[model samples]
Target: MPELTMVQAVNHALRDEMRADDEVVVLGEDVGLNGGVFRCTADLFEEFGEDRVIDTPLSESGIIGAAIGMAMYGLRPVPEIQFSDFIWPAFDQITSELAKMRYRSAGQFTCPLVIRTPYGGGIRGGHYHSQSPEAYFTHTPGLVVVVPSDPYDAKGLLRSAIQSEDPVLFLEPKRIYRSPKMEVPDDDYTVEIGKAAVRREGTDFTITCYGAMVPVALEACKKAAEKGWEGEVLDLRTLLPLDTDALIDSVTKTGRMLVLQEAPKFCGYGSELCAIVAEKAIDVLEAPIKRVAGFDVPFPYTLEHVYMPHADRVLRGIEEMMDY
Candidate 1:
């Protein structure tokens, strides 16, 4: 077991999948020659060849549209949008075409595609380069949205995304792409989609978070422990088909909840969690299910530190919940 960065784990998933299945191909701007802006696809062009590792123009719509077409023709096309902010141009292709193809065609057609994009702030990517758009895809039917918190899950989940029959949105947190590494097993492994990973267990309270906020939540958990409080951290790897049972169990035991997310406050995935908690475990709650999230406004460049939910905000919410 050798530790590898998140980028390396993703690269291994793509390479292994392509080697195993001839239909697997990757296409995105600079994915061929430049190896992607973050070099997430470095050396893929040479190893997979230009045909399998194709590069396209700046049109996000065109890249996604073509991938949809390729999937319909029985190819597993993995496309990248460079950044999550730039994926809007392909909204119709993803929501209308890719999402509804199987249902609209009555199983006559299918789009087995993976759209990978780096999302969330932390690298000072500003509004254009940094934004969490998973909630958008989660709202659309027939799309699988996934976000991995670490390299091991990154590799396993990407492999699962590539092999799934339905279209998948693979959201990677670019900020941790190279900073975090783990000794992922050498053998083949595929983390099941729609599962939540419990990073730490405690009975005092449950702090459920995802993506870029996971490490922050972990830090908050450590702080809570030092102050004589116990908290559990749930890493929601899959946005859709969330592990409701795990969520319910943790909250039922702790009798308190705080949902953490990097996305904006309004209409965020956090809202859905709030509803689910209230519905399933209202009686078990000692306090309202609080949420710490980014402000509703567009991600601000200069004030991003305050815009995105921080560890302090999370702890404050937790402390309030405990007092209640």
Candidate 2:
């Protein structure tokens, strides 16, 4: 019933969950008094107080490791990594310990932890602050990777991630953290995980993307429409356990496909989508699957525009697909 930015919606979700659930606790660097570097946790510290909302040291591994421990014991912990580029320090803790808990214990225990982090380039954050590393966690066995494109999905998907019985990697696209505003319901609701939303419908082709690239894909679709190329755009709210059914269904009707991501082209989430289409929906394809993604290089500070896949670049890829 109100319009809010992605970051504001995230704050709403966190506050609502904390109020409804006593076990829900939030902790990270500068998350309490500072209210997070991006201020997504703004006012939360004052509302929830110190015990429920805590500020930890600058150790990424300690933040995640402690969250895992808290989840293992009876608390539902939501730990923020500040930035995704800094998440690698906790890779072992996430992959080896948090991800393997339920599987290793044969369901004797579960890690209901939400590892929240701001990710992606476009804010001139350069290499250290802006990077899309969702692919790494998607490859892990016992983790659910979620990326919401807009305010509504951000609130809903985050609520689902917090309530899920399994470990979740919640990557918020920092690039569009506060720009666009969309209507989000005030009442509590959860968007189902592992489902993709069809943003724009078309019959010529389909553009599959997630996170900040969702807006890029939509813009590409609009550009293509001017040329009479009606392309469907699929916003994959969840990356891991991808909604293969939605992808195949759209490709089946459109007969052309393009997968996009802000991460590097090689081994990125786009690659996985291409592979799935080739394996399951190739027969319906009118053209080879195309991938429009960030180049296989470190994100450049000066040339941030070139490092991100924008509408123009995506339109070029669509042209190539059409020509091929």
- For TM-score, the strongest prediction is 2
Worst 10 residues of 1 by lDDT: 179-188
Please report the TM-score between candidate 2 and the true structure. Answer: 0.99
Task: Summarize candidate 2's per-residue lDDT along 72-139 as a digit string, tens digits.
Answer: 99899999999999999999999999999999899888899899999999999988998999889899
Clashing pairs in 1: none
Deviation (Å) of 285 in candidate 2:
1.0
Q: Once model 2 is optimally superposed onto the true structure by TM-score, how far is the C-alpha of residue 302 displaced, in angstroms?
A: 0.5
Model 1 lDDT, residue 320, Cα: 91
Poorly placed runs, candidate 1 (over 4 Å): none
